[model samples]
Target: MPTALPHLPTSRLLLRALQMDQAEVLYRLANGPKIADNTANIPSPYTLQTAQDFITGIAEKYRAGEVLNLGMHVQATGELIGMVSLRLNARHHAGHLGGWVAAHARNQGYAAEAASAVMDFGFATLGLQRVGSQCFGRNKASARVMQKIGLHYEGCLREAFFKNGVYEDLLTFASVRSDWERAL
Candidate 1:
């Protein structure tokens, strides 16, 4: 793991770099219909090959310092239950955020807490001026996590994503360092 990529801990979760050993957990969570429906970039019918490819390809991103892809794990069990990441850009001072919790971990506030920790890393540690997240307009749970971490409702690109044989609007939310500080 790169030292630039920090392993952040919340009360119930540890957000750290994804290891090759986590392919099984990634396969389970990333393949679920519910998880696929919420993310814009994830293909439906996610396969073992996709998981293996993802594990292999993620190394280049970490090496380049362009993204921080962290697995969300339960410290007690050392089980991989989810994933959270910061997608960086050179032209933009902000990073895009995303995550997915296992079916069994849903509604436990792990997403929000893990998200908060990553946002803190982005703004405080990485010196990003802002952090943003976008969700399918219908993904209330993910949108709620963004709001819980103090990301304001910025705007929505109407009918921006064509997925699952339908076009859905995308809701964009963001939080400045000031907003994050206030939330603390």
Candidate 2:
């Protein structure tokens, strides 16, 4: 795995490494009920310190070939819109995909576009054999993005995720290297 993070370009977005300067923007975009409720990891009261720590940790993770978390930025306006990530399991040559688009950026296809770019990097650049994603069962938009990216629906894991003091069903989706290649 390479130490340097990648810059993935889509038609309307630039997916790049998060910078320290963008911590505040990340905090603002992520510090909301809508985002926290849907995601497994992000806390509801997301603070600036959390964003800072994440940005700081991502570099080390990248260097260790453990993860890649890219900020989604609009190419035209250079505005930070969201984030996409791939957490690698080198032993299995697979990766777990995770991401979120800001409330203002939802329903615009940004999630699918950015996610596709990262999946491309994972298979083509990092030699990953499989990439998978899971979303809360209620997040229909996220499921759409997974399908749009050519990930086949696997199944639902009932009460697999614990978030916000409740159990939530998780819908899984995935694409192996062969399927991903055929899609391209």
Candidate 3:
């Protein structure tokens, strides 16, 4: 099945597919120490060239239909402040949701708001049976976003995430379509 490109909205944000021109802004967000610590794939010193490479990879991934990576933009300023994604594995018909807001944009409910938009797209439009998220044990902010969006608190997998030369627990959270509907 061909997946549609879904553009979602919140009161002040628009979560749409990533564009090549968004590299510079994304570079700044991904390079932040706090943002890198919360994610497994983004390196610590995310450079402009690294962001360019990321944009290239995302372009390729979009063509392949392996993931739907969206840029979180402020509607008022027309700036790319972060990203939210719905990643699908074609073989299993299962997907994962993830997101990050720039350091300057934290504590304003942007992440949770953008994530809620993606969750609505996943369940209401895409017809996904189950969508979930994971966070590093130390990432309380991300965990809170999950809860704020109504995802259930699933158990942690002890020592499951090996990062920065040490093993850290990973907390898994999920929300089904029913749960999402109830929250609405």
**Which number leads on lDDT?**
2
Candidate 3 local lDDT, 101-129, one digit each (tens): 88888999999999888888777776777
What is each predicted model's overall lDDT from 0 to 1? Answer: 0.84, 0.93, 0.82
As for candidate 2, its clashing pairs are none
lDDT of 2 by residue, 1-184 (tens): 8788888989999999989999999999998548888888888699999999999998899888788999999999989999999999999999999999998888899999999999999999999999999999999989999999999999999999888778999999999999998987
What would the TM-score be for candidate 1 when compared with the true structure?
0.92
Candidate 3 Cα errors over 4 Å, as ranges: 1-4
| lDDT-based ranking | 2, 1, 3
For all predicted structures, in order, the TM-scores are: 0.92, 0.97, 0.91
Question: Best candidate, TM-score-wise?
Answer: 2
The Cα error of candidate 1 at residue 127, in Å, is: 0.7
TM-score of 2: 0.97
Better of 1 and 2 by TM-score: 2
